[model samples]
Target: MIWSVISLLMPFNLEVMVNQGYLAERSGYWGFLLQHPLNSLFEGGLVHLWFLPALMIAVAIMALLIRQQKTHWMLPIAIGLYLYGEFAGSSAVVTGMSAPIYTRNGPFFSTLFVVVGYLIRERHILWQSRSALLLAMLGMAFHFVEAYGLHQYGQVFNTNDYLFGTTLWAIGLFLFLLAKPDLGRKPWGFSLSQSILGFYVSHLLVVIMMMNLARFLGLAGLEKDTLVLFGTLLTTYLLVKGLERTPLKHLLFR
Candidate 1:
C-alpha cells in the first residue's frame, strides 16, 4: 500500500494527466470509479491505469465476500479487469509515456505479477534457487531484448515492468536467505523503507537536476539518458543512506 502511494506521488503519468485535466472528465461507471487525474491517463481518458487500482480493491473485497461462494471467479474477474485495461485503446497509449515498449502488454505483465505474488504467498513455496534463477534470467532476457528493440526502432517499453519482475527475484532471494539459519530470519531487517521511499519519491527530481546541470555545463548534446539515470540512482542511494542515518528517517520513511 505504501509503495502504491509512492507510485502515485512519483512525478510520473499521474502528475502530467492531472495538469492536463484529462482525468477529471472520463466515460462510463468504471471511469467514475477511477475518476482521479491519474485515472484519466490510465483509462485512456475513460479509465485505464486508474481502473487497475479500483479493480484490485474491488476484486479483493469481492474475493473476501465470495470466499464461501466460489473461488474460481476471483482469478477470472481479476484477469478480466486487467486485460480490459491493458488491451483497451486509450490507456494503452497512455502507458507508453512511462513504459513505452510494454504499454500494450502492461495488462498482461501486471496481471502476471499479481497472480504470481498471490500464488507464492498461498503455496508457501517462497523460494528455490533454481526456480529463482530461471525466472530472473527469463525476465531479464526478455527485458533486454525489448529494451534493445525500443532503442533501435524507437519503440517504448516500461522500465518499471522489468523492475517489477526483478524485484520479485530479489524478494525470492531474500526469502531463501532468510530461511537459512545462518542468515537469520530478518526479512524486514536492514530497513529498505527509507531508501525505497526516497528513491521512488525523489529519483525523478534527481534526474531533472542532473539533466539541468549537464545542460548548464554546456554538455547537453553529449549527455546520455543512461548516464542521467545512473547518476540519479546513485544520488538516490546516497540520499537514502543519509536519510537513514538521520533522525528524520522516521518522518520520511514511516
Candidate 2:
C-alpha cells in the first residue's frame, strides 16, 4: 500500500523495462506491475511489489499442506509447479509463444523456495560451509550450461527468468548464508544488512529519478547502470540511516 502510493510519485511509467521493447507483452501488464489495483498487486501489479503477493500465496499453500499432514508432498508439488511456471512463462524460448498470464507472478517461483526454507526449519537440516559451497558452485555451473543450451538449441539467446539451475542456485546460496551466521557482523556490514530491505523497496524510485535526471543533464553515458547502481546505493543508504532513527521508520522503512 505504501509502495502503491509512493511509487506513483516517480516517473515509473517511463521505466526502462517497459520502454526497452523486449517485454512488450509484459509492458501492457505494467512494464512491470505497470498494473491493476490493490487486489491484484501480487500479479506484478506494482512491478517489484510482486514478491509480497507471491510470498504470501506460497506460504499459504505451504500452510495448507502442513495442516493436512501432506508435508511429504511439498517439495514434489513445488517442483511440479515451478516447472509449469517456467515453461508457461519462458515457452517462447522453445515454442515461440507466450502464455497469457505471467507465470512468474504466480505461485510457481515462490512455492519451491518457500517450501524448501520451511522444510529446512521443520526438519532441522544443517549444512556445512564446504558442502554448501560445493552445491553453490555446481548450481552456478548449471546456469552456464543451461544458458549455453538455450543459445545453441532453444529459440532464443537467453532464457526467461529461471532455468532449472536457478532454484538450485538460490537454495545453495541460502544455505551458504545460513552456514555463516556471523559472516557480516562488522559495523558497516551490519548497517548494510539492516538497510537492505530499505534499499530494495526504495531503489526503484531512486533509479527512476536518477535516470530522468541523467537524461536531462545529457549524462546518459556517465549515468549508465553501474553509475546508477552506486548512486542508488548511496542515496538509499543515507535515507535509511536517517529513517532508522525516526518513528516513520516503522511505517516507511524499517
Q: Which candidate has the top score in lDDT? A: 2
Candidate 2 residue spans exceeding 4 A from truth: 13-40, 43-45, 95-98, 153-159, 223-226
| lDDT tens digits by residue: candidate 2, 135-162 | 8889888877776777765536453577
Taking all chains together, each candidate's TM-score versus the true structure is 0.49, 0.80
Where does candidate 1 stray beyond 4 Å?
1-72, 89-112, 126-128, 135-194, 221-230, 244-251
Candidate lDDT (C-alpha), each? 0.51, 0.73
Model 2's C-alpha root-mean-square deviation from the true structure amounts to 5.3
lDDT (C-alpha) at residue 81 in model 1: 46
Output the TM-score of candidate 1. Answer: 0.49
Model 2, 157: alpha-carbon shift in Å? 4.8
Clash tally, candidates in order: 13, 3
For residues 121-236, write the lDDT of model 1, one tens digit per residue: 66776556666666656656654664565445443555333333344454455455534535533555446543565665556556656775565555654365656877887887
User: What is candidate 1's CA lDDT for residue 61?
Assistant: 46
Query: Which 10 consecutive residues of model 1 have the lowest summed lDDT?
Result: 42-51
